[model samples]
Target: MTDYSSISTKYRAYNITPDTLAGIVAVVKKFTEGPATTTIYLDDDHEVKDHNLDALLADSFVKAQKIQRIKIESRKTLGPDLVHSISINFESDMLRVVQVTITGDRDRAILARRELDTLLHGAEYWYSFSLAPRSSFLPFFLSFLIPIVLISALSVFLTWLFGGEVTEKSTTGWVLLPLVVFLAGYFGLKDYVFPRLTFDIGRSADRIKIAGYWRNILLTGIVIGIVVKIAIDRLLK
Candidate 1:
C-alpha cells in the first residue's frame, strides 16, 4: 500500500466556508477512529477562542490551529470565492483514512465517505459477487436474468409438487416467483445462511467469507435447477 501520509492530502471544494470546514472536521472525527489532524489553509491571519469556528474566520479563511487532541490546522484558500484546496497529514496505525471526491457536490462526497467508512469498519464480509464497471451491461443483464433463472428452476419444483409436467404454460405463475423468493430469502433464508451482502472492499480481514460462499452455492443450485427444468420443459413439449 502507498503511504497515505506521504501522499499529500490534496482536495478542492467550491465555495468553502468556516462552517463547511467545521462540519467536515466533525464528520472525519465521527466516522474515523484514532488520532487524526486537519490543516486548514487560510487566506489571512485570524484569532480563535472558544468552540465557535465563526470567530476563527476573518474574511477569506480561518486561522490554522490545533484544537483539542484532534489536531486541527486551518488556513485560507487561494481565494475566498474561488475553489479551495487543502491537505491533511496523519500518523498511520491509529486512524483509517477515507476520502471521497465528487465534482460539483461536496455534501454528497462527505455523506458517501462517511457511509463508506461505516460499512468498511462496521462489519465483516463472508462472500460477494462483484458487478463491476457500472457503465457496462453485465450488471443489468445478470440482475434480470439471474432472477429469471431462479424462477425457472422454482417452476420445476412446483411441477414436482403437483406431479404435473413442467411447461411454459404450466409455469406462468413463475412470473411471481422472483418476488416470493426475495421475501423468503430476505426474511428467512439469508439470516441462517449468509449474514450480509456487501460491496467488494478488496481482500481484507473485514471481508465476510461465509456470505460470499453461500451466495455462490445458492447461485450454483439455481443454475442446476434451471438446467433440469429446461430439459423437463423440452421433454414435455
Candidate 2:
C-alpha cells in the first residue's frame, strides 16, 4: 500500500488547485459518521485558497451526515501556509465526546477519526457516564455541621437576651432549645433547603456532589432561630 503520508507530503508541495482541494475534503468526510466542523488555516497571502478549501470541507461534511452541522473557520497565521484542524463535539444523555484530528494524508486521515471513535467507546469514557459521587468528608461535614453549631449558639444567645438569665434554672432550656432547633433544621432542610441551594452545583457535578457549605449552615440557623423563639415562649408561660 502506498504510504498516505508520502502522498500527502507530495500534495502539499505542489499547488493544490481549488477543484482538487474540494475533492480531497470530500474524501475525508466519508470517514466520520456524524457532522463536523472544519477549520482551515492558511498564510495571509492565500485567502482565496483558504476560502475554497473551507467551502469544500463544509460541503463534504454536510453530505456525509444529515444530522451533522458543519462549519468552517479560516484564519491567516505566520507559520504554516495551509493546515487543517477538525474538531467534533457530540453528546448524548449518558456521554459526551470531543475529538480533535489533524492530518496530511488524503486517506490516512481516517486513522485519527477511528481513534476518536474508539476513545468514545473505551472504559474510561464509557464509565464516566455512571456518575459516581465524589467524597469530600470535610466539606460534607462543614456543609451540615457548621450551621447547626452556629444556630444552636445563636439560640443560646437569644435565650440570654430574653432575660432567661443563664442561671441553672434557665440553662437546660436555653441549651435544649437551640439543640432541638438545630437538629430539626438539619433534618428538615436536608431534604429541602440544602438541595435547593446546592442544586446547580450538585447537578453540574453530575448530581453526585454538593456545595454552598455556608448556605446550608445558615439554613440550619434559621430553623434553630425559630425553635429557640418557640421554646422561650413556652418556658416563660
All candidates' lDDT scores? 0.39, 0.39
RMSD in Å for candidate 1, one decimal? 16.1
lDDT of 2 at 119: 34
Kindly report which residue stretches of model 1 are placed more than 4 angstroms away from their true locations once superposed.
1-76, 85-164, 171-183, 186-207, 223-237
Model 2 TM-score on a 0 to 1 scale? 0.27
lDDT of 1 by residue, 140-160 (tens): 467446655666566566555
> Among all windows of ten consecutive residues in candidate 2, which has the lowest summed lDDT?
6-15
The digit string of per-residue lDDT tens for model 2 on 12-89 reads: 011122343343345445443323334332223221223344564344332232221122322222234433344432
